[model samples]
Target: MEKYINAFTDSLLNTLDYTWRAMTFDVPWYTNFFWGLTAISLLVWLLEIAFPWRKDQSIFRKDFWLDTFYMYFNFFIFAIVISGVYEILGVLFNDLGITAKSFAIIDIASWPMWAQLLVFFIIIDFVQWFTHVLLHRYEFLWQFHKVHHSVKEMGFAAHLRYHWMENIFYKPLKTFGVMILGGFEPEQAYVVHFIAISIGHLNHSNIKITWGPLKYIFNNPVMHLYHHVKALPDGHRHGINFGISLSLWDYIFKTNYVPEDSGTIELGFPGDEEFPKTFWSQITYGFVKPKKKQPSN
Candidate 1:
């Protein structure tokens, strides 16, 4: 009977290992990328149609196409460039023996495929929430990050309108650090990457999900929208949700805020309202001049 039980366990382990290997590489980046972009874009447009953040329909005009182009450009071109840099940095760290030794507490890879994904999502989100809060509170880093907040509208494309410097300094570093510390295999890290990018697009989307209690679990569109609010005088804009996947960290750290009476609080930097609408202007302005100081109460 003991021999039979051992055989059953061995077979299950083999099956799980095979399944994880298959699923990890089975990810068709082209198909997933197109579908993810299409789905998120459609949701954003639908929200605009339904809620109409601004009565002036012109807000979503030809200029929107320009902004959309810049968005996709950054997502594909700039993303690739920064990721290449990250790979180089990872290699350097490995050579210097700076990474954590293999000591993962849970071997989720031996579990069911879905379980592995859940673990990855939860862990990555926890790391991101803390890193995000640090970036906001630290004045030096906020200079580069403020560009993201300069967006006057919250749409799906708004997610990609980040300075490449911010991505270089944050996502790659934090992700690489977590992978090294967790001793996650390359395949496991890949799955986390796909999931993170997909959810990031979703979080910045215009889709209206009530989320209810689930808001505590997943960082939904509404929660993220608050994070985009430009700083104000009476108090900081009632937008502080910073977690990309889960809101647990934000809640734990006292950074989560959702006002019951607020509705589409004015989005964009304090002085960005007068900035040129051109893409070049936005990019240059973000880096050239120092960020306008937040008004003191």
Candidate 2:
């Protein structure tokens, strides 16, 4: 018990220190995710300004600052807050003799760096896609996910506006993908990380792009915009376009729904009109059981 407590405290402090270093650019340029995310966001924002799909939407659209705050909050602040739980779990797993290579599905350590990265990207992307489907499929999960669907005006920062609980769901699956590869994480894994971030930012940005024929492979703003639409298809009450970085999953699973490319389509879920707008409320929004509707005679 004491060991686990101590591990949590040490890990929490280390996470904070590492975050500070990244923010101050004390880390290597390539591994500095803080500034890397900022640079990518700025670049995408510029594209949105230059070629906005919604011409009438303001540069500072609705909830722009709110979504921006969510970006940093989810990325750094939430990680810092949850570091202790992860550290405790790691300590417990270590005591159980469980290693990263314990559940090896295939040995990729001998593979070339490019091969390792490609495999890592594909596996993690599919994990995220599956997790996304869960967020929409279950009502309990959808309550937490509604915070993301609350975006009436999508932008680059909106990509990270999801509820913190989503991190709880996603990070573990991604880590499992890493573990399944027999701890074959390459030193250049940051390359795949940055690429995912860039793709996510572009997918939510106002700039319309189908990537031409590559649209079948990569998720784009147009396809993702429909993911935020209020109406679900006749059969897919859960959702559609659940891909994170790859459109291939949606295509293969028959969940792809791109009826039109019109940017004027309305966004948000059915009851989102009553959804919380403030951060505090949103973070705590879905905890309580909602009141059931009374039947009318």
Candidate with maximal lDDT = 2
Residue 206's lDDT in candidate 2: 96
Against the true structure, candidate 2 reaches a TM-score of 0.96
Residue-level lDDT tens digits of model 1 in 72-105: 6665556544444455555666667766444345
lDDT of 1 at 43: 66
| After superposition, candidate 1 runs with Cα above 4 Å error | 1-35, 43-63, 99-107, 185-198, 231-239, 274-277, 284-287, 290-297
- lDDT measured at residue 34 in model 2 versus the true structure, 0 to 100: 90
Model 1 residue 34 lDDT? 40
Tell how far residue 239 is off in model 2, in angstroms: 0.5
Across residues 53-118, which tens digit of lDDT does each residue of candidate 2 receive? 999999999999999999999999999999999999888988999988888898789999999999
lDDT, residue 199, model 1: 65
lDDT of 1: 0.62
The per-model lDDT (C-alpha) reads: 0.62, 0.93
Model 1 TM-score relative to the real fold: 0.71
Clashing pairs in model 1, backbone N/Cα/C closer than 3 A: 226-239
The Cα error of candidate 1 at residue 63, in Å, is 5.7
